[model samples]
Target: MADPLPGDVIDRVEYDVERGKVREFTRATFTTDPVHTDLPAAREAGFDDVPATLTHTVVAGHQRDQRGFVDALGLALERVVVGSVTWTYLRPLIAGDHVIGTRRVVGDERREGKRGGTMRVVTLETEYVAADGEPVVRLEEVLIERGEQR
Candidate 1:
């Protein structure tokens, strides 16, 4: 497969921060934090509504979709693994806030694996902004795609 060039803008997506989705995410992640599920509690915490969890951007950013970059690169989902991820939150993403996120290919590298195969590391950096145009979160995710031994 050809390498995806660095600084490639992979996707631009806009999504809403629905309260119901926040509740579901919090419950599914076992994140018993009321701020993430209860509106009143969120208001008490100085938010207008429930706030999304840290990892919510993964879903909100449409990173799980198996199209676009992943498909273009011909990467096998079964051979891909998350190498690392970092999140920097500038502001809480509250329910009802529409978010616009842009994902870019920041880094790409090929390395020899310990098992004598080839490993490709792809790093994607995404910045999400709220409806007000304020930056909400910046996420960097590294994915490793392993190739069979030559």
Candidate 2:
């Protein structure tokens, strides 16, 4: 595949926030907040059901597509590093919520590395929308391809 350009749509995936997965995620992350694992607590907290942790999207994203955008771009896995990740939560994601996420290439550029090499920086943005068509979260990830090691 050719290099991905800005505005390129990588893929769209559907994710279901199951109750069991939410509890498992909370336990795995060592999150002690009852709102994530207990439906009653969630309801008391003003949510309809158990609400997933803010970072639960990462798990959902991976479960939907292990390869993700890096593999879609055909970049060598060993040469790529996740530089950073940022999340914007527009609303709560609760158990039983069906979300549709669309991943797109928002920025592509090259920069000179301090060690005398070129680095390819790619910014990927995934917008997750609820069943009602309102956006729930936006995730931005930066992947850096370290040019051939000198």
Candidate 3:
């Protein structure tokens, strides 16, 4: 089977309202849009609350899954290559919301490179909502960490 990188990992993160970290991410990442910073701007955008910058992902144990992908192939992390990074948000992420822990695979063909080179790409999807879980926001994050070819 595709047991190249055969380990399991879980990442846990929490987000809330009235924090400067969001604003800091916006500024550091060069996301100058007011919606990402100014609550007033977000309101104009039809958002009931401030929006989360695209980069503000809950990437905690992300690397752990990548490590598993490699182990399943019987190859080490030094054998692959990072290809791309992507994330999609189903709804606007506002403050004072918490997202639960979710699991995702390396996508189709996580370990397809064994000869020329490999792109160890993994896309993670997440959702943030009120305590009731109405699906307020959905996000898909892509992480690529290359490995070595033997």
Candidate 4:
């Protein structure tokens, strides 16, 4: 496969935030916030429904795209590692919200490794938008792929 170019779209998926999923994610993450699992608590917190943890997007995206963007780009999964992840939350996601996430390639570069090989760094950005076209969260992730040793 050819190297992914900037602006290449990896995938787009729609995720439905269900109450059960929200509660499950909260418990799995060891979150003690009742607002994420209880409708009454969430209503008291000013949310229309149970609010999902900030990191719920990770699970939602992963669940929809199990192969991941790197794998979609045809990169060797064994040589790839997540270098960093940054999230910009524009709005809180709650149960009953329908979100559409689009993953795209934003940047790509290669550098010489200290160990005498090449290191490819890829930057991907995924924007999660609500059904009403409002932005919910923006996730920027950097993946590093190590080249073969000389």
Candidate 5:
């Protein structure tokens, strides 16, 4: 029963703010928006209580579950492939906030691609909330279970 798929609940995710994580994310992502990478600029821009970039918050929400999901399926990081990723930002995320992410299996379907094999696309819908329980953002990730498309 388990080999076909994991459970409906992915895992609970939490992110504690780290200045290094925020800074490194800003630098590496190549996002030049001052409000996203500069604290002083963000303050001047009227976001005195929050960090510059919300993208880091999004990353935090995601990275929290990568490890657990791998284990759930008895999968090896080396064997699985991240076929695609697309995120729609509903609200701006701020720094210095604790974020919680919860994922659930929203969809599961099998299909055949160009190779005419079976591929399973499992949709994981995640909701990231601020510590106050305010919805910060929502994310939907479609993981293509490659090689399984037979």
Candidate 6:
């Protein structure tokens, strides 16, 4: 498969921040920060409402796109590994907020590994924006696909 251009959009997803789900995420992540689970505490912390964890955007963006993007590159799940992840938070995500996340290909590189395998490094950037068009958070992920020529 030909490589996607730098500005190519891979996929877009929309999600609603449910309070219950946010609270559940907080618990599962073992976050004791009340700003993520309690509305009152969040307000006291200067947030308008209960704020979801920063990683939630990654979770929402990656849920259904894992195979789609990998397969598009003729790679499978077993050969793909997360190389890195970075988040730039512009604004907090609150419960009841409607968000649209877009995944775009920012860069790509091919290299020959010492083991005689071809590896593709894909750099993708996902931006989560609120319904009002305010940027909530941005996630930059680097994924390494191995055995592309095996």
C-alpha RMSD of each candidate structure in angstroms = 2.0, 1.5, 4.9, 1.7, 3.3, 2.0
CA lDDT scores, all candidates in order: 0.83, 0.87, 0.56, 0.87, 0.66, 0.84
Better of 2 and 5 by lDDT: 2
- Show the colliding residue pairs in model 4: none
Q: Give the runs in model 1 whose Cα sits over 4 Å from its true position.
A: 61-65
User: For residues 45-71, could you state the per-residue lDDT of candidate 4 as single tens digits?
Assistant: 899999888888887555565576557
Q: Which runs of model 4 end up more than 4 angstroms from their true locations?
A: 61-68
Q: Please identify model 3 stretches exceeding 4 Å from their true place.
A: 1-14, 58-75, 106-130, 136-150
List model 3 lDDT by residue over 61-150, tens digit each. 442465654455444455434454455566666755565544444353445556656555655455445566766555555555555434
Better of 5 and 6 by lDDT: 6
lDDT of 2 by residue, 60-117 (tens): 5565665765578767788999999999999989999999998899998889999898
Cα miss at 129, model 6 (Å)? 0.9
Per-residue lDDT, model 1, residue 113, is 89
Model 2 spans with C-alpha error above 4 angstroms = none
> Tens digit of lDDT per residue, candidate 1, span 53-102?
87887775353465666786567877899999999999888889898988
Name the runs in model 5 displaced over 4 angstroms.
Answer: 3-7, 50-54, 61-67, 73-79, 148-150
- Across 82-144, the per-residue lDDT of candidate 5 in tens digits comes to 565555556666667677887777766767867777666677777878788988777777776
Q: What's the ranking of the predictions by lDDT, best on top?
A: 2, 4, 6, 1, 5, 3
Cα-lDDT of candidate 2 = 0.87
Clashing pairs for predicted structure model 5, backbone only: 51-95, 117-149, 117-150, 118-149, 118-150, 119-149
Clashing pairs in 2: none
Residue 56 displacement in candidate 4 (angstroms): 0.5
